[model samples]
Target: MSGEPEPGLVPEHQRPRHDECESVLLTVDGEQFRVCAQAGRPGAYDFDWLSGPHEYGFGLTNSGGLALSRDELVQAIREFLAEIDPATGYLAE
Candidate 1:
């Protein structure tokens, strides 16, 4: 796959309901963090470990989790990364 960086940290403004397939690599603490976007239906989507050795994950939703949105997912990723153990190297100085 191309090493080219993906779009900005912001999620796409007008993405299709079933066409979320963006992937990006994030460098943290000298390690590469790979984040991929998937399509979620009206309900919850099953969590799967497609690639990498990420052993931690966090799930966040709307005020009531009425439905999962791209923005919410991105926010969750940011929060999760913030809570990673410093020794794990998932976090940087």
Candidate 2:
């Protein structure tokens, strides 16, 4: 959301358990969403929202072992955002 993580959503020291995965705080329409991308097996990525009770995520990778690009990551988060109704914190109709 802001430059800092939303209170209680993440601890200051919170880190991904897996070394291959990296996390970033993404802001869309002024709402903050944490996106984690795991460089799992070749040609696949494991994505998750490691921020709250309402989890929204997806993954994409190429069979050629291409890593998840920044655009892809943001797009994933955007899709997640589209599903959530910010006012009510529920799925958007």
Candidate 3:
């Protein structure tokens, strides 16, 4: 899907004003996922993943309070996807 965020996944009014926000589309096992991160207060990141009508998200912070690189985010997404239960399409408990 050109690896671009789907139009309207994030509303314009809710988007961060800064240019630090980054987003991309990824497909895994034929499922399309939208991943996004915005630099938050103190340089940490608020990130989320959206697939169809479901979304999972969290904040991320480190001692250094640096933003995660795109590659790093992608790796993290892969790990997150690995934990999803195929039967329910949600993270396994």
Whole-model lDDT per candidate = 0.37, 0.51, 0.51
TM-score of each: 0.36, 0.47, 0.53
Whole-model lDDT, model 2: 0.51
Taking the tens digit of each residue's C-alpha lDDT, what string does model 1 give over 1-93?
111112222233433233364444454434444344444433232222123244333222233325445554444444445555657524333
In model 3, the clashing pairs are none
**Which runs in model 2 stand beyond 4 Å of their true positions?**
1-20, 42-65
RMSD of 2: 8.9
Q: Per-candidate RMSD vs. true structure?
A: 12.1, 8.9, 8.1
lDDT of 3 by residue, 1-93 (tens): 012112223454554544556666667555565545554544344445555335554444444555566666555556666766778666667
Which digits, one per residue and each the tens of the lDDT, describe model 2 over residues 1-93? 211112222332443455546666666556565555544555454445555345444445455665556776566566665666778565556
The deviation in Å at residue 64 for candidate 3 is 1.4
Count clashes in each candidate, considering only residues at least 3 apart in sequence or on different chains.
0, 1, 0
User: In candidate 1, which residue pairs get closer than 3 Å at backbone N, Cα or C atoms, i.e. clash?
Assistant: none
The per-residue C-alpha lDDT of model 1 at residue 47 equals 24
